[model samples]
Target: MKDTTIDDISLISIPKIKEVRGNLGVIEGDVIPFEIKRVYYLYDVPSDAQRGGHAHKELYQFLIPLSGSFDIKLHDGINKKTIHLNKPDKGLLLVPGIWREMDNFSSGAVCLVLASQKFNEADYIRDFKTFKSFKR
Candidate 1:
């Protein structure tokens, strides 16, 4: 098996109002390019927290740090990449067949995730050794 990485992270920013009684804007079909099927958030986690120790066979995910910062370790079977997510406007788009681990969360960090598919336990590859053998 090999260390894996995929290029799917993309930065997204939406204009927000800074004052009371101020108008906000929404660009139709511009921000959030994906059709979201589910919305979730990971919060109230301590420092050195670790999540997502599996690979999806047929699901897509977009991860964003809502409050603080964290590190995303991504693998795709042949390469590995670590991304530092600090800003709220930036998100990582994780495609299928990529293993990801979310760790090194700062205090009061809130992670927002959008999914393209529903939850399926069979779609997860949990064993790292099995993932090693799953490469092309």
Candidate 2:
């Protein structure tokens, strides 16, 4: 069974250390549930462009907006949610089997992603209908 409901999605708060010079954000092993196997980022997005029109079979991802802002639309078989990411110290945790689409990126927005697995095309459900069937 490769499925998790939308309720499984969660918000994660990264620990921040304040300083006079600059504030530092931390994403230690304890801050996230999984051992991150990959790190990537999306930037320089056009305002009308969108991303992530897919779902994973068994991958978990944590997405953070390092700069500017963006909106992520998530959907389960029966439920849907939209989340806005703006702060650098906050992130969204996406469990497996949930559909996700990203859009409305502010100029210079940088979306950092921490994944539990390395890039694998076989793990992705790129079609919404297939994703819905998978969730069942």
Per-model RMSD to reference: 3.5, 0.9
The ten-residue window of minimal lDDT in model 1 covers 1-10
Q: Candidate 2: deviation at residue 1, Å?
A: 5.3
Worst 10 residues of 2 by lDDT: 1-10
Which tens-of-lDDT digit does each residue in 7-65 have in candidate 2? 89999999999999999999996898999999999999999999999999999999999
Q: Any runs in candidate 1 off by more than 4 Å, and if so which? A: 1-5, 12-33
Give the clashing pairs for model 2: none
Quote the positional error of residue 97 for candidate 2 in Å.
Answer: 0.6
CA-lDDT, candidates in order: 0.76, 0.93
Candidate 1, residues 26-121, lDDT tens digits: the string is 323646666788889999888867988998877777777878998988787777888898867567777778888889989989998888777889
